[model samples]
Target: MIESTAPLLSVRDLTVAFDTQNGTRQVLHGISFDVMAGETVAIVGESGSGKSTAATSIIKLLAGTGRITGGSITLDGEELTHLSEREMERVRGRAIGYVPQDPMSNLNPVWSIGFQVEEAVRANGLAQGRAAVRARAIEVLQQAGLADAAKRLRQFPHQFSGGMRQRALIGIGLAADPRLLIADEPTSALDVTVQRVILDHMASLTRDRGTSMLLITHDLGLAAERAERLIVMQNGSIVESGPSKEILQNPQHPYTKRLVAAAPSVASQRIQAVVEDRGVETLEDLAAIPPTVRVAGLTKDYRIRQGGFRSEMFRAVDDVSFEIPRGKTLALVGESGSGKSTVAKMVLKLEDPTSGTIEIDGMDVSGFSRAQSFGLRRRMQPVFQDPYGSLDPLRNLENTIAEPLEIHGVGDRASRRERVRELLDQVSLPQDLATRYPSELSGGQRQRVAIARALALKPDIVVLDEAVSALDVLVQAQILKLLADLQTELGLTYLFITHDLAVVRVSSDLVCVMERGRIVEQGTVDETFANPKQEYTSRLLEAIPGASIPLGGL
Candidate 1:
């Protein structure tokens, strides 16, 4: 359905700037690109690289003092740069659709899902009556991969899971059947399997409707696999632009090379680079090490209240057992709602297992008294997924890290202050950042602070629950390298829980694949990835966004 001759969308010499307290500051400079009818284009870069700024500029949705300083934006040869607010409103949903990055922030919590989609349909004049709008809403939701859309139309955003909410947003974006769809990091936070379903649905729907797509993301693997042409952006400039395969195989820019090397999906093939960089022992050499934490017959269940006086027992974790060898890593891999986090909570003693035995260095913790539990806390700690949520916004970096040591009564105020600086150094954070609050730091820096806080007590066992899942590829690589180096230097153990299989390959010695409430497969990382025994495990590997595309291959 694509027309190879003419461009559906075109932008030339686009320059954007913002009026800051320090005066005018330009963010994007001389950016130009074209998207042919039904073709997909992707803009890739790290945070603050002006990728999202460009996308937002196309829709004239920039916040605050942002304005287009210079450039021309045209759609179907219609100039849009100088359009009035009122005129742009008519062109928004009717000619161009936008799927924002975060569904929780974009979707209204007070409204039902059906109302939102219906509103878009009515606003674009795609449907005449309320009944027609409702019918169209259901159709779009179903096309977006939400099963039983009609039955769940009345549900609020909070009632749906993260994946379901994302699908709902996609449904609303496509409700008007716009000519162009701009998806901004649509699958960044989703599990690989859920991401695959959403992406596949978008591909089929867009192709069927002849909708040209412009994807904005930091993930090079995803962009390489999905986009027909790739635009590599750095410091608000286009360093490289070419066919995705050609750019991957022969990157002309230094930034592009760094991006490819840092990406986890492709880096799995060059994992030895990580080991060499950290000088850590291979998994085979670490096999004889005794486990720092051991679990046997772990099970967790919850009672869900049904109708009056009735409840149903739900098994959140069923007979889940794994071991983290001293100075080694054990990764739990699964999709969302697969009991990986439940198992982590049980191990960290944050949740009580219905029936199981947890032994930390041969000390049974199932029957620990209050005093004994407090003692256990000093030896094991947790680093959660959302650093923003985990860190205390009111507390500065020093106090956040020092709080743990103070809780355990480890040292005096003076000694604790020195320890905070040392912990910052250990996590590769600048010492000057100790006085900055969480809000002042970037996402990667906040996560480093969280890691420093977890290590304040010198815990032998650290449980990282999706710790690197939210990070950019380069930041994730740095964090993983730091973890590996710390493991080698301090001999610490890690219980790594994540839905990202690409990460498990390079960072973990052992892999456990969980599904429903049980582990469907467990083995060494090499064995499991090389020959997955379970169908679910194989499916998960296949679901990785760019799994089929070889690194640096045409």
Candidate 2:
């Protein structure tokens, strides 16, 4: 792909710092790299590793207290560091297009998609007159792979799916046909299939346009697949830089190695229940206990009004049935609005199933009285998707874990304190973190505390609804491993819900694919993934980033 030794963009001795109440905290530690012409390069690392910080520094759009303390950023031999705000503005969309991380937040809610596209096009002076601008907007969206571009132009961001919103952003980014495109975690929030579609279209457009891309992500699998060269950042410093193949197959840095290891593989880290005999917790009796949780013909319906005083029924979950074995994980895998979460709510007894039976340990929960319902709560607990939203910010780690115990009146003050300590230990958190609030801990720590809270009552079953979806790649791996270890020791059954099929491979023993409020396929992970019976399941597996990359041998 390299046509010449000359580079398109270059940075030298780049350093970034943020001014806070505490003091100046340097982020990028004199990092330097080059993006050659027509080349797709990637910088990858976990949160706080400064991968995003470095990317933002190039455009001088660092948020809040972030500022470039020292660096030499240039484009086509033109120095960008000394440019004024006006000059930088002119260089931004016309010369360097940017696709930000969060589409929902970045896009304006009140404005239509066409309005946003027109704004970008008009701002760059790409086309004249309202008619010309409308035509150009449609053309860009069509290029971004959105069908019926003219009809959907009036649609708002809320009306668009995650994939569509991302494509809209891509259309806006490529509106002016900038020489270089900076894509920051473009598909992080999308479904696997949707992500594959967006990536494929973006790759095709960039290649056809001969545009260089600076792809930023926390996923090595995606970076390996989309980018030719790799720059691994850690703690604000560059750890390794080389070809993507060299970086993945023979990473030298420990952090890079961990990232590579964290990359989800089709045939790796098999999903199995690790039943460790701790003497106190015996798995021998679990076999005799009928499936910890069972469901038959589960369905949920809602009402939507058409016009006047008339409304029709909308089925959210349609005849979804599955069984979760003792101490094993069964993941409900699907994209957004696939009824996976609705099924979870039904299982939790939060909603009444219209026509189905949900049995816990061979006992139907349909006619459970108030007291039985309370006891059922003790037997089953839930770990939600967003740990930050789920956890109480005002509460300390100690109290957060022990809050469940306090609510159920399981133990006295002294016992609860000791139990909190034990839970911290179980989750591999420090003893001193008992005094720290959620804000003081990292995302991974907060999630661990949530797990500890879920396990406080020693629940027989735990329902995780998109639990690991919000975490980075490496942190997600660590959490998965932690869940496996806890399952082995505590012998706790798990109901894992996620949109990521790749995640399902390493985390669940059995897998069920959901699409449009129905179960399309269900089987063991190995059998189903090896040969998916349904088209939806096949697309999901095929959509996994780097699915074509041969990483198993490594």
Candidate 3:
């Protein structure tokens, strides 16, 4: 189905470098590829492997120290590499569209979705009249698989869910109908179901529109399914490229082979082993303690606005009930829109439930006073998804981690510093890193800092919302091990909200499967994973991508 005439985008002997004090460090070394019209070409590589650098270089968005030192880039026979800033700006949105990696960071939080999309449309000279622009925005939002697009456009970024934000970003990308679309990890932040839906929408849209696509992702399976050609990059070099199926099945390069093998599927890795080491506390340990937190008949309903003041009550968490014991982990697993995070937010008192009895340590926390809530907060801490975003960008590591101690008046200056140091050691961060800001640290290091910050208060329970999902496999394993070690040392409890079943199997004593605001299944990790009773649970288990491959091979 690929149209292989004159290429839509072409790059020859591309080279990019960053000027560090040590010298010019080559990031992308002599890479060349052609993307034809209506064809999808995927670029796959590990983190820091120059995959994103390549994309950024193409758009001339590379950092101050980085530049494309050599190579020619052409789109529709017009050279793009040597364009002026103003000229490039004119060509960017009109000739080449872009969907960034994280929609949340890319979008304006204060603006309504409509204004953002409309601005994109106006910038590209797509529509003249305001009404026409709004109409086009709604149409594009619907094309991106968002329901009630016109009504949803009025909602702010925070009001919309993470997946919805991704859809909004995609809608903005398609507003101008650019000749080529450059999507950089568009679905990485989304849950599996939402990811599938978005990918299907993108594939369908580009095919129908005859728009060429350049997909940059770490997910090989996604590339295999969507792209016509595959270009593998590693250590700032192009290692291989050819037909997608051929490369996937018979990769010539070791890196490509590893990438292909890492594609997780249902038949790949079996859910057999415990996440924790043997001789650790099991289900019996949970049975020993009375419930630490209990929710019975939990429900939340939002008044959704339709047309001209018309409203309808939408239930997000519908009669969900569960219990968590002290010194154990209770994992809530589901794809996006499955209401797992809604339950966590309610538990954290970020959102008030419409109806439910939520008891913490045999007492109801649903209606706690300010003082009582402060006490509850001291008992329940949170570790969010993005460590870099959560931590203070302006504050140094010591202040950021020790701020909790200062807030609660736990210890004086000397004692707090000592505690901060101890916590840093506990999380395996170097002592020297205490002076650095969050921006200076790598993704994994930032996450470690977040973990240290979460543990600073010595909270009895920690709500980890997709805490380790963003990390690489090796770093993820380290963090998982650290969590287990912490549980043993501190006897801490965790409310782990994640879509990763592997994390559930390894870290949780109990697993709760959520679907559309309801608890579809709940049991011991072994029982539920090994013998999932409900069809939804079975499907979740089945949806564990590339599970059949051996970990060593991957």
Candidate 4:
């Protein structure tokens, strides 16, 4: 793992600027860094910290009037700042491979996985004929840790799972035998276990190929674990830079310290503690007091066709049971395709359970009529993971939040609009945002807007499915705090679904660990996290980025 003395990629006094409607705003303020031959370097910080801006500027791919206003970028002793569009294209794939953050956005949905890889291979002149290019595509996918590469050659991006799509993207990036690879938050959207697997495979692949990597991410802990060297950025400048272990052990900068502390690893104890006189006193008292939401023996099966009319039954959720007391939070945790989301869907009425009984405030929903189902929906609401996607793009914030009230015939236009204002205030969003659209707001702002919309109906139970997983540490912290505050103020029950164990430890009262299609473990978050009975649960905790780093000082 020792890198040579000579630097493979050297960036000096680099500055980046974007032209907004107001004026040109400079983002990266004369930053400098280097990547040694066969070395992995990570630039870590929160969103808008210039990690991605700097990475994009290197290849002259800055979006919407953004440009490298100052400094030099030299790769393999070649000055890249002066390269033309055509020349840069030649360097992009063959010399410098790039794996972007979102695989769905990066990969074309219309094309098969193999077609994209073959295109990259053929474009680089790696192979002449289509047959040869296809063989190279399979080999590239195998290198990216995708099993059954040949059989999945015809699969579209939508047909593949999240991990599979990421592997396909990696395959396309590394197809041309590039000397350097730049992965920008490549596995940020994946679950912790899947993230670990992808990163391990990527590390092994790069090491074996002797390809240097410039990893861009918002996760300081993940950067510390994945990279040999770390460069911390804040407000468009490098606050600290050094060996990963050294900086991780003792973060010197205030922002870096904030990141370390805000990381779910060293976070708050619990979202909201139960009072001695109120809420469930103990687990045994659960039967004495009626739970707000109860799910029992939930099972869901989907029939999937295997080429011909031959279809097989696939059980998504199987015999899972849990309960959330009034105003308490229960976290559903598992890897991808682990039935956590399916369970959430069943509770939310998005999916029908093959066999189960779901009770809301002691009212069983199995035989509910149309009017009862409508009433049930009004009592329950969901805050989805993708805030922007969940909200209507065409509607303004006020309309979006008021839509639920309108559909349920809650109030008049004036009252609904006033309620919208109140909900926004409750979520800490400004009133002026009512007129704005989803595209105009930041990720955090959109999430707040989503929360405001979810609370419009004044539902008793809220289903948060991977709510804060996509946000940065700071924004995520703010969202978690907001949820906690809302829960206390509104007496709302939550069925939180996520893959982040650290967040589960702090945000929920109870934790239910699912694997494949079954609930493997369920208990109090503190007890379960402190002493995980299942090895799968233990492995998940260990898979957390930089879990080995001691955070006692932080």
Model 2 bad stretches (over 4 Å): 1-4, 271-289, 306-311, 369-371, 552-554
Q: For model 1, name the residue pairs that clash.
A: none
Error of 2 at 46 (Å): 1.4
Candidate closer to the true structure by TM-score (higher is better), 1 or 2: 1
- Candidate 3 off by > 4 Å: 1-8, 18-26, 63-65, 76-78, 84-95, 105-139, 146-161, 175-179, 232-235, 239-292, 300-315, 335-338, 349-379, 472-474, 501-506, 538-552
* Candidate 1, residue 347: lDDT: 86
TM-score (all chains, Cα) for each model = 0.96, 0.93, 0.81, 0.95
Model 1 misplaced stretches (Cα beyond 4 Å): 1-4, 266-287
Query: Comparing 1 and 3 by TM-score, which wins?
Result: 1
> Per-residue alpha-carbon lDDT of model 1 for 1-554, expressed as tens digits?
85358688999999999999999999999999998899999999888889999998988999899999999999999999989998898888888999999999999999998888888878888888878888988998998888899988999999898899999988888877889999999999999889988888888989999999999988887898899999999989999999987887788788898888787872384243234554434556555777788898999999999879999999999998877778778999999999999999988888889998999988879888889988888888999999999999999999999999999899999999999999999999999999999999989999999999999999888999999999988889899888887887788888999999999987888889999889999888877888889999999998887777766521
Go through the candidates in order and give each one's C-alpha lDDT. 0.88, 0.88, 0.83, 0.88
The whole-model C-alpha lDDT of candidate 3 against the native structure comes to 0.83
RMSD vs true structure, all candidates: 2.3, 3.4, 4.5, 2.4
Q: Could you arrange the candidates by TM-score from highest to lowest?
A: 1, 4, 2, 3
**2 or 3, which is superior by TM-score?**
2
- In model 4, where do residues sit more than 4 Å from their true spots? 1-4, 266-268, 273-282, 285-289
Clash number for model 1?
0
Native RMSD of candidate 1 (Å): 2.3
Model 3: residue 393 alpha-carbon error in angstroms? 2.5
**For residues 77-113, what per-residue lDDT tens digits would candidate 4 score against the true structure?**
9999999999999999899999999999989999988
Regarding lDDT, does 2 or 3 come out ahead?
Answer: 2
